[model samples]
Target: MSAFIPLSVPNFGEKEAARAAEAITSGWVSTSGARVGEFEQALADYVGMPRAVASNAGSSALHLAAMACGIRPGQEVIVPTLTFIAAVSPLTRYVGAEPVFIGCDDSWCIDPDAVEDFCANHCTLKEDGLYNNKTGAKVAALEVVHVFGNMADMPRLLDIARKYRLTLIEDATEALGTKYVSGPLSGKFAGTMGDVGCYSFNGNKIITTGAGGMLVSNHPDWAEHAKHLSTQAKSDMLQFFHDEVGYNYRMTNVQACLGLAQLERLEDFIATKIARYNQYKDALDGYHGLRILPFKTEAEGVRANHWFYSLYLGETDLDRDTVIAALQEQDIQTRPVWALIHEQADYPRNEAYHLEKAQDLRAHIVNLPCSTNLSEADCARVIDAVKALV
Candidate 1:
């Protein structure tokens, strides 16, 4: 029997361990420590944001961003249904904001046209540049996710947000190293383009903080406010002060130590992933009934981190499940894209719009092994197995 080719995992070298050891030895194992502050600064600089706040998890970061953006009960925020539920779940639960689920375009990001149409029909304008919806609650924000490291149509999305006066909160968890190439926002990283951006350091992400996340913004006050709220809204530093209800969402010093180490090798990690992606493209080229999913580089002049490589099974004689089963039979781990969030039992009652592309992709898309540690032999084995199945 051969080794089981796992789908995705973190790549931690000697530096990661050393930094973690230093954090432990320093006795600053909690959230308030030098490692946490340094990690936040390094991430802020890397993403071109003025400030960053580290959090215990990516979902907490999203929740903090939603709160800072003033997402209130019964308000609407546009979100793509084809994303990890963590991106939208926070808004729904923490803020009591209702998500108007949108569809993904070719980039697997939210379609701007759908957003504009939804706003035009459902929302009205306020004097302060906020969009109020038909239900009398303001459309608090627009959550744009950079799906699978692909940049969304930022120009159109930004224009729509501006015209509608919607706050743009970017869920950039999967696009940590992706950068736009053209336009006014050109040369900007994914998370920096929006009003506020959040990142994840989950095990399968491009970088790992052993379960941590960061919230960033060009606006210093927004980042500070998020930090304040994340750290339990304490007013006075001298006393155990409590002003407003807050959360214990801060990231530990130990996690930040790991994050700092991972950040140092981000560029190298991106290069490796891109190389493997190109190899997959070459190997899969001209194979029948399979289309290599496209990244967002061409449209936005952006370079993706290639967090995970997907294949769109186009009119295949074999169903998606069959193809996945075939790959698994060969000890290759391949899985389907995320189930559409609107279809989930928890969000059964949410409003969903123009979800054709998302629905189609969900049924046909397959994600193969894309871990940074995957060797050339592993890549070839996956390619061979996919070819044999097709």
Candidate 2:
């Protein structure tokens, strides 16, 4: 039997092991180690950001962004229903803001049209900021996630944000290497285009720090504040004095070392991912009802990392569960896209706008094996198994 193929996994080798060993030997394995800053700087340079703040998790980085943005309690953020819950939870649970969920476009990203409609029809621009008429809360921010490494409609989203005084918070946790290849925002990475951006180095992400995240901003103040808040808000070096409420959310030096090593191979990792995605697309073409969702390139003018290749099973006679079961029997792992955030238990009462596309996408998208190290042989085996099952 062949080894089980996972939906997504980290690619680590001797370099990562060596970095870990060095950190262990140096005894600065905690948050205050040199590698932490080195990794942070490396990421900032890679993304074309002025400053970056390292955190324990992507969720924590988002929380820090909200706090640094001065998102007041009872305020609201425009969000997408199609993304992972972490993208929405940080604002609602940690920052005391409300969510107003929007639908996704064909790109499986937050719809710019829906965002405009919501702003024009449902929200009123006031002296202070845009206010949601239904909830009567200031719509302070627009949180856009680059779903499956595909860039969102940033140009239009930026227009709405600027016109309404909404701060753009990019949930770029899944799009580290993704960037616009054309248009006004050409050469800009996913995280750098917004006022603040957050990234994750989780085990299943394109890269891994074991478990770490980073917050970056064009505004130096916001980035600096996020860094200050991440480390327990320590006001003095010698004392445990905290001037404000903060969390112990800083990433460890050990994790940063892993991140440094991983960053070195990011371009190569993206190359492999792209090749694998193309392989899947080429093999599955016209295979009947098994549509491989595209990573928008020419249409969106972006070069995607192709983090996860979505195979929509909606048109097929096979439902997601049946496909999953069949794939599992062959040791090929597959799963449905994330549940719409609005449908989750905690967000029942929050508003979910015309979510037709998101609803369809969530029910049908079967994330295929997209590990960085996945080879042609692995993909062929997966395709064979899927074809055999079908």
How many backbone clashes can be found in candidate 1?
1
Q: Which candidate's lDDT is highest?
A: 2
Q: Which residues of candidate 2, in runs, are more than 4 Å off?
A: 298-300
Error of 2 at 41 (Å): 0.4
- TM-scores for all predictions: 0.96, 0.98
Distance from true location, Cα of 54 in model 2, Å: 0.4
Q: How many clashing residue pairs are found in candidate 2?
A: 0
Q: Which runs in model 1 stand beyond 4 Å of their true positions?
A: 126-134, 298-300
Q: Per-residue lDDT for 157-237 in model 2, tens only? A: 999899989999999999999999888889999988889999999999999997989999988999888998998888987
Our model 1 lands, by Cα RMSD against the true structure, at: 1.6
| lDDT, residue 268, candidate 2 | 96
lDDT (C-alpha) at residue 216 in model 1:
90
